[model samples]
Target: MRIGIPQGLLYFKNGRLWKRNLNALGIEVVTSPETTEGILSDGIRHSVCDLCLPVKAFFGHVLALKDNVDCLFIPRVIRVEPDAFLCPKFIGLPDMVRAAIRNLPRIIDTEFNIKEKPEAVFWQEVRRELKGDRKMLLRGEAEAISTNEILRCAQNDRKRRNDKIEKDHRLQKFSEHKLTVGIAGRPYLVLDNYLNKGVVRYMNRLGVSVVYQTPEKNYIIETMSMLPKWIYWSMGKEVVSSVRRMLEDESIDGIILIANAGCGPDSFMTELIDGTLPVHKKPYMSLSIDEHLSDAGLQTRIEAFVDMIERKFKYN
Candidate 1:
């Protein structure tokens, strides 16, 4: 049986684990194509009004593999990192896809809670759903867990070795170039092009260098210190952690936060950020990303936010 994996949303975090696990279980997997306009169009056409752009893109991926694959791997990844749940929309994604598609494709349901000893629910669910033998399933589980640990270590190493990347960027001495604006947000927002109105292009057109803010030493330190003790949500941590680091770095002139509408934790943190930003480097704006593209008000907000930052720091 063929399984379809979407390249949107949690694809980056789970790609390696899913591929390795399923392959070991002797199941063939198929993935939706890279993000493109056609996929965006498909998503826009089928998605609900309240759905976010990334959720829409997710539907686009599922729609793309409608007939070709036997079952789709649309996981209900509510909590990948302990008590920190994924976006609520992600929790209901399976139901959304079922409604959007004419023929509800078989979906392999798995709940990933990192707090529960590393992919335990995942292996249990996968073993039952995929119908793998005892030995095969056990081996796949061990291998998959090991792969994640190795990846985590490598990510840690990359953070340690990132001095070179930082030094090179610093040495460039971009005095003569366009403004360098840092877009610091969750991976879903930063990586998603359609959701954020092609932020890279938008920033480049405005003569701005977009800085990527993923977690590192500076990011973690700033997050642990700045974010409130009660903001224990995982995705919230991702955003706050990066934003803290971005604020500390002098190289990042301004910061942009792109989040989904109805994101509870984001709304709270955005308020916290806006209220507290006056003390830090203090150039920051938050934009809510949704599937509805016809909202002119949203466009105005984005334009105004960008323009505000540009005007404030243009001469600096």
Candidate 2:
């Protein structure tokens, strides 16, 4: 059976793993096309008026795939790890889609709360919900885990190689005109080109190198330890920790915070990050995006932010 996976929300983070698991189970997966004006428009048309931009985009993705697939895999992810939860929207996403959208294929809205149950249990629940073969499910889980480990190691190795290269005096001349700016936000907003109106590419065109990385686990723990209160949202911790890391790094010239216009967690996280910036004395800007945001306006603001950074570098 063809199962459709929408390219939105947690899809940015867990899409690969989900695809790997399903493909290994001998199922055909049909993913919606990348975000486009049409897709976002479709999303906005069907979704509630108050929904965040990402959720509206997600609705569009679901509509894109509803007709092509026999079923949809939109899991209700509550807690992936202990002591942390996803946003309230994510916990209620499947139901929201059901309520808002009409005439959808069968939804595989399995609840995934690894905090309460082991990951193996979660997989078993998914297998049962999908009616997938038990052996194939186990095989898929194993393969996904192995692939994740390899990718993690490769990313670490590449980061180390890049660090070594950055330290070399020969490459310093090449970076003279480039300003490294750290863009911190939810993966969905930061990584989705159409959703963010190609901000990363625009920054590149303006001679600004953008960096967005998930900080290592130890670094996240260390950074969050200094906060007055713990961040309970998984994505919030990542954004906070990554921003802090970028602020502390002397090589990164500036930082930008990207957030959906109505995201509650982001509202708090951005303020928390902003409070720390005065001490670091780093140039920072926050971009709040919605469906109504204009491409030209975003570009103009980015150009101005980059100009300010360039002036700071020149005078300092």
Candidate 3:
């Protein structure tokens, strides 16, 4: 059987694992096309005016696949880390898709609170949908675990790169032609070139290297341990924790915060980061995207930000 996955939101976070596991189970999986102007418009037409841009974009992806696949796999990812949960939109995403789009294929809406359930149990939930052999399910579970470890190793490699940058104080000198700027926000926005209007590429065009909000997962755990209060929202905490860690790196010259318009949790976190930007000599900017956002405007903002960083960091 074929399963359709929307290429937005949590999919950006877990798509690799999902694709690897389903393929292992001998199930064909199809993904919606990347977010684009046409997709965004379709999503906006189908969704309520108040939903965040990423959620609306997700609607578009599902709608695009409505006629093409046998079933849609919209997992209700409730909790991944301990004592934290995803935004309400994520928990209610499948329902939103069902209400917004018409005549979609069977939806495999499995709920998972990873903090409360084991990996085996989550696969078992999928097994109920497939009714596949138990041996296949077990094999898929093992493959899923291996996939996760591989992703963790990649994150560690990123940490090592960051550490190298930190040790080279000369790299922090603004006079250097190449500069590294840390971009922090939801993975959906950071990872989606269309959604972000190619901000990462634009940065590269400006001779600036971009570092994402994704730190080694273990580093987030370490940073969280130092906090006096536990963050209840997983994504928000992850971004903030990454920012907190990145702020200390001398090699990171500036920060650009990308957020979806009308995202309450993101708004709070952005403001918190804005108000308490590190005392060091780093500039910060926040860009928010909505259904009506224009790429021209976003590009202008990015250009201005890059210019500011360039001037400030220029070797004296």
Any idea how many clashes model 1 has?
0
Order by TM-score, highest first: 2, 3, 1
Best by TM-score: 2
Error of 3 at 80 (Å): 0.6
Candidate 2 segments exceeding 4 Å error: 132-177, 277-280
The candidate maximizing lDDT is 2
Q: How displaced is residue 269 in candidate 2, in Å?
A: 1.1
Per-residue lDDT for 1-316 in model 3, tens only?
Answer: 6778899997766676677566655678899988998898899899999988888888999989879877888988898766789998888988988888888888888887878886557766775676543434544444444434544544554445444432231222333347788888897877787887778777777888777645667877776676666568988788887787678888788888888787989988887666554624577788887755557888899899888878875854
State the TM-score for model 1.
0.73
Compared with the true structure, model 2 gives a TM-score of 0.85
Candidate with more favorable, higher TM-score: 1 or 2: 2
Of candidate 1, the 10-residue stretch with the lowest lDDT total is 165-174
Give each model a TM-score.
0.73, 0.85, 0.83
Query: Cα deviation of 108 in candidate 1 (Å)?
Result: 0.8
Ranking by lDDT: 2, 3, 1
Backbone clashes, candidate 3: 2
Residues 1-316 of candidate 2: C-alpha lDDT, one tens digit per residue = 7889999998877776677566655678889999999999999999878888999999999999999988899999999778899999999999999998999988988888977886556655665676653434544444444434444543454456423422321223334447888788988888787887788878888877777767877898887788888899999999998888888888888888898787899888888887853534788889988776568988888999999989986998
